[model samples]
Target chain A: MTRVETQDRRQQAPRRSLTRRLWRAAPPGLRQPLGLVAALVAAAWLVICLIGPVIAPHDPLAQELPRFTPPGEIAFLGTDELGRDLLSRILAGARVTIGLSLLLVCLSMLIGSVLGLLAGFFGRWVDETIMRFTDLVLAFPTVILAMVTAAALGASLFNAVLAALVVSWPPYARVVRSIVLGLRGNDFVFSGRLLGFSAARSIRVDILPNTLGPTLVLASLDIGTAALLLSGLSFLGLGAKPPTPEWGSMVSAAVSHFDKWWLGVFPGLAILTVVMSFNFIGDALRDALDPGVERR
Target chain B: MSGRAPVIAARDLEVTYPGHPPVHAVRGVSFELFRGEVVGLVGESGCGKSTIAKVLTGLVRPAAGEVEYHGRPVRPLGVGRRPLAQTGIQMVFQDPGSSLNPRRPVGAQIQDGLDLAAKRARRSGRRSGAGPVGEPPADPANVRRVIGQPADAAVSPTAARLLPAGSPGRWLERVGLEAADQSRYPRSFSGGQRQRIATARALAAEPDVLIGDEPISALDASTQAKVAYLMSRLALSQGAVLLFISHDLSVVRLIADRLLVMWAGRIVESGPTEAVWSNPGHPYTKVLLGAIPAPDGAGRLPLVPPSAAAFDAPPVIHAP
Candidate 1:
């Protein structure tokens, strides 16, 4: 038996290794190109968040002569009501918008995934209590919940992030819990038990890994929603305070000066682009990770 | 095999699911599994065959009665913080597709048993106050000792036994799987292939008792025969007791040396397979055997409904 297995492994050594299997699953032709472009745009958005502060043309908080300036070569993209460079403000806002949203999403995913695993794997009253709480959170309108949370927390960048985290985690918990529920009865999990693995080991090895693909796909999609919620709170004066130049706050500052197209348009466009980029990546990732969709 | 002490013995094992009206799944079931023999448990669906299997494997704790291993009562399901000891009992589930995790490669899945064996060996080694037993413990040679295979290599007397590398491939091969196919995920394989992979994984643990809960019920007839033959052969070669559970009496007759017939949560009749086939003592057993379709289209034995008194009577525990 040992000799035969060794011979088989040697013969199949040339086959693609396990890590490569994920990439090989990417659909060929149009979807592949689209997925690549979406991935690159998302990557670019991440890079902008990381380096945007350094690359802003002028101090984003600086009050200057030309306030509400329109699109042109000088002060290109234009200036806001405070006379801060619109281009510089939008670039700097990436740091707050993308950074806060990512942080919010990661925190939520962590909390949700762990809770979900616990509820699903342990079932009984644990499942009921966690899921009922999740349902209570999910029952509310997400933005309203964030707004209420932000209002109660006293409206700062930190408070807005906290609000988003609170509002966003329930979906993750719900999704992960459902996935875990389905997986609990699976043979792999039972196999883990039969092998004398501790419950913790079985969950870590057999259950948690299976939950990741769906949870990740949901998280990526939620990134766009989280960004929208963060921006909305900032627009409502509950996010980053003035001079911080958050995209939503920029649009709010420009709302009264609606005629000044660049002020609102550029910032609005920034939010749109970032949100769309995440949506695209999320869609592509959903396809990429789907077990049913065979890769070429 | 019959005269020796049973490796695993269940005395009046009962399992019930709590609900508005509790489900009485198994009642007063008793059985013994001797090493180097195959014992077949046959019953109609929902007659508690699978539940009994679960009780034995520690997946489901029996609500009543005890399962003793080597004469010591152990938790049916040894979850969290249990002492590290090879129960030498593994199960092959009915559905391979659902049994294997979709995200993992079959090879990785197969390797899990080996990894677990190594962990058990290490834990047990530490418990015995033996300094590290083998060279690095994870080495395949040391792993062989972990899985109960005799190791040729001389190592520190305190070194713990662990499952050797390439054992997964060997076990897969024993179950008629190609060694190279381990890299594929469970979703990529057909039903038969997946079953084979599942069997390999169960065998890889080198269990002293292997239980099949209708392991081949989902396979085609030809595939069923091949797998059944493979399982019995592997179990005998490894000196592991096999508990073959199925509704198909013909298949049970093919592999099992001892036959246990269960009906409505009770073991109705049991004896040597040939003896039971020649003369079924219980009415339910006769109905079951008569139900097997003959090639000549012969009529089945008249169905004998159990008397109401029979249903009301307390379960008759079978003493092996």
Candidate 2:
């Protein structure tokens, strides 16, 4: 084969996602392995979510009709306060929790990434002004910070998402800003400008694509945290109301029947299973994407 | 050189980055880079030289006219997306250390690209290392014989089926490094040493063309000569096309067989290195030749503003 063809053959061998293709193309020094893996894990989580609802065994919300029963027949994790199947409720709840968490994270990343790109690319007094504003928000204790937002907006799934996003986006914005600071001065970015990537497209293509390697991992890890925060809000009666089958609200209802321990145990277990698995996936992804990072 | 195919042939190219009415960085640049022959691109800071470098490599899109590789409109001036011809071309960036992920180890970093290429041949069922993008090492004995090494020895690849052609250690020494330095990160090495490592890494891939965008620009003056010497050594040793880009005229003069000059996205002058240096015709060409500071600083002069006539005059075109 001609040398280029040989090389082409070699490169053609590896089928990859857009992220992997982009990462592989970067010089060895620029590859941040842990960050890539984390992002991949997040993407995998989304994939898992896509096929999950169909495979869930029993209806996640099918009531057992026998109240306070422990792991037994007709119900996997036993019954809740209304004699509902715990496993059923937990399985069904994964759809909304995973779906909404993704939505909130996506919206947050979009808003934060764009703002960061604007702040970073324009740099000047504009950068300073936006940076200070993010800092002001950052100064607030995050949980308490999200609380005030939830209160002002009034509690609901969508509103909680908005509140969480307001709290979450600053970190993404900060990360993207720093990255843009480095990228904004690069030859490629300058080349993009010269090539007519335009100020916006340059940031969108040259800058934004690079930022995702890190930002996405953070967003993935943040999903589990965001879910927890939303759950915690619900536990405090700031989330979805009864019969909504929300994990946090179910946990909240379990409080009234403390003597019936299965109610609290099952919901808490559901939260733990989803959160822990996501955390593991995040860690694995960080490892895989950053094959370069020296594993600790 | 003229008979050989011109992989990259450009005529009167211009580049303007968007800004206040757009800053015209490179104007009327033109040249032909032959297949298997290295063309040296040189100019001072903000002269639109680097812009031209990116234009050819497909990393930077050009704003006007044609940048053809093998008669294919690889990256037409103002092409919206990267084209196939451009995709075949790859770039070895300025800072090798910074170009890599800070947190990753060097082995995997190298392995990452190798792995990606290997994965592509999944249907071919070729194992990762000894495929088309890479070659089996030449016999270890050959490397030892070339460098007269006593420091180390290993199994020769002369009879091997899949490894690259030579011993990795001797190759390191060939690139002006000790075998021990192979295991060390680029950070532990000096600026010159790091550059040498980058050159070695680029050499490892055995690419069709190597575009060194000021590969030695980041090194100190004292170290530049050796690094330059090592690059020439590797290029001759491997016979890969070397397109050395630098702003240092003195440096470009030492290594280039053919010299291509770019000013504000246009080629003001180009010819055999000796020809362009001795008999520069274009005004910009004369400016560049005269711009070179003479020994004892006698020939040194400040940049004179280009007269309005120089600005308005159509760019000079030098087609092969």
Candidate topping TM-score: 1
Q: For model 1, how does the per-residue alpha-carbon lDDT over B85-189 read when each residue is reduced to its tens digit?
A: 644678899985687877788888778766665565566563211222111323232111212212321112332234333356544555656556677788779
- DockQ per model, Cα: 0.47, 0.04
lDDT of 2 at B50: 67
Candidate that would win on DockQ: 1
RMSD of each: 8.1, 14.1
Query: Candidate 2 — number of clashing residue pairs?
Result: 48
lDDT of 1 by residue, A1-296 (tens): 49999899678866977755555555542156666676778788788888987998888888874766677866878777777788888888888898888899999999999999999888889899999999899999988999999999998999999988888899888899999888888877887777766779878988999899888888888888888999999999999897787999888877888777777888888888778778777887787778787665
Residue A232 C-alpha lDDT in model 2: 78
Q: Give the fraction of native contacts in model 1.
A: 0.69
TM-score between model 1 and native: 0.82
True contacts kept of each: 0.69, 0.00
Query: Which regions of candidate 2 fall more than 4 Å away from where they truly are?
Result: A1-166, A177-181, A184-296, B75-88, B95-97, B112-174, B178-183, B294-320
In CAPRI terms, where does candidate 1 land? acceptable
Model 1: DockQ score: 0.47
